[model samples]
Target chain A: MADDIKPRLRVPTTAKKGEVIEVKTLITHPMENGQRKDAAGNVISRQIVNALKVTYNDKPVVNVKLDTAVAANPFMSFFVKVEESGTLKFTWTDDDKNSWTAESKIEVA
Target chain B: MNTLLTRRTALAAIASVIATRSALATPEQAKEWLAAQAKGTPTEGKITLKAPEIAENGNAVPITVSVESEMTEKSYVKAIYIAADGNPNPPVATYEFTPLAGKAEVQLRVRLAQTEKLIVVAEMNDGTLYTASREIKVTIGGCGG
Candidate 1:
């Protein structure tokens, strides 16, 4: 569960100060919902990315509470105000108690 | 004959309990859930919900919610709720935002059990509620897949 998890992010390279910019993220995960049966007819235990948090310049921008209804690869897009040059940090936590983090930087001119 | 009747009554009771547990929320139930979350706040305009009218695969349906807001210190969107009336879990996801979030917009992927109405509710900083809803037709089921 820990080896294959990967976090991806996209943000503008540069933006005018106080400008609104879009941030997109996608994570490669199986997001097993725990309801499916394997070849042996045993129910698979659920393992999903249940939460995601994004911050810009150390300020929290978006916090999402996900559920089993989310698909295999979770993708999220939101907007943020670039007040200064800083790094955007993204974190994903799964049901297995594993957490992954990724970061991207943006220049506010 | 008396013993048979008693056994039948017990079976009926168990069946009713199982039905209640597995049944999905009806339209009214979903509405009540959203209303309770609103907490007497009036639902007005300023919410835009984008979802495909027809989803080829219910396993991964893309949805976006955007609200008209300046997102300044004085006023901004505090939270957003996504709900689907037909799914086993009516409340899909809830998002929280701060003033640093320039716009009140969020995009995510969700699963639909069948054809149902998806609802988006936005809570403003001043305690106002804005809402938008759309119906999505799912060709293939996604929840159990």
Candidate 2:
């Protein structure tokens, strides 16, 4: 199993009401595609994060379903419209059913 | 007529193989995938796919998929699927969006086994479909190798 998993985000802490902001996220993972062979020529099993879900103030914003073709240390960026001050939560799930969560707060004036 | 078309395609394939000096994925499988993934006949507008014309590295090719929409509760982009024809498995990702997303745009990185075509199909809240694609040339394969 891959270790040292980490999640990173770049979100503006403040925004005007009804403003559209970009949310950039990056997670550390090997994203093993199961296509590689070790020194012994044995096939490596695939291990990858399969999904990412984002919710704003408990309302769903977006959910991305990942596949083996996604590169390692998956990175994504998307836009969100903030109307109020609330928390934006992110969840990433892997093939092993392991999940990591992160959150960012954006204050809207 | 069919035979003539087949021969012409075969000739083109040979020419392409010689130019690249490697085997590549034909557009057939990718076209079939696009057709199958779409809920219905997808139109040619409302969506845009951006990628480098020539990706220096295939392991991490950046791409952006954008769909035109007002992003309201009644009308918005519901889902988007991306696939690369040259990969062992074409599917790259599927993104689902709600009105809260405000804009139906996403940037992602994908692995491409070789030079191939990337296709994207989007489904809207109203059940309409939009499609777009791009051809990316890869200098090195991104698969396990």
Candidate 3:
């Protein structure tokens, strides 16, 4: 019953024209790599987010590949130059073929 | 009596290896992984990797990587790769960027099995390679806790 996975994002609602801004995103996941054992000494199966994609105004911005070396509850921040008002979409895909998404809009003057 | 003693010694050796096991990736694994991506030996400049000298926890060690890039259609950082020599896997993450990004910088947290060297490599659009690294001392292992 690992249905508590969720995506959260922090993006500024507005920006000056031609201003560079930062976008932060986080997701809740165990990110288990199958190396750790419990009190009973049983190996935990590996489960982690495999990739993350970000698009701005329907154009690709960044593509990230996540591996077992990434910690649990992944958090990432990147820089973007805003030229006009548009929407930013973030998609996170996991090992189980599950994809989660979060979006935000920015108004540029 | 000699046979029994030898068996006991063998078991102890195995146990010691397990207890001291830090990471699955060896030092060479990290190099091989980097070599596979880079066309030649990458020079050590253009990218700045910031990491704690002593990380209290190995599960989430905060790191920030910034590279000098104009982020224009002509010249920009095409991709950045991160890996640790002392992790279960050498390849940690790869970030591909486009001209839309104003800069080539990012911040995130990573898992490290123990005290080891963390490496970051950057590939420019013109096929130039740049890299930087830092050593982090983790008090607790990445998976132990």
Give stretches of model 2 more than 4 Å off: B1-33
DockQ each:
0.67, 0.77, 0.76
- lDDT for each residue of candidate 1 in A5-59, tens digit (9 for 90 to 100): 7888888899999899999999999888776788888988888898999898778
Residues B19-129, candidate 2: write the lDDT tens digits: 653444546666676667666888888888989999988999999999988999889899998888877777889899999999999999999988888989999988899
Clashing pairs in 2: none
Worst 10 residues of 3 chain B by lDDT: B16-25
Please give the TM-score that candidate 3 achieves against the real structure.
0.91
- Regions more than 4 Å wrong, model 1: B1-22, B25-29, B32-37, B42-44
Q: In candidate 3, what are the lDDT values of residues B56-94, reduced to their tens digit? A: 999999999999979999999999999998886878899
Quote the RMSD, in angstroms, for model 2. Answer: 6.8
- Candidates in order, TM-scores: namely 0.86, 0.88, 0.91
Candidate 1: C-alpha lDDT: 0.85
lDDT-best of 1 and 2: 2
Report, for candidate 2, the interface RMSD: 0.7
Tens-digit lDDT track of model 1 for B1-145: 9999999999999998667545854566667777876665657689988899999999999988899998988999988888888876676777899989899998889988788999878888998888888999999978663
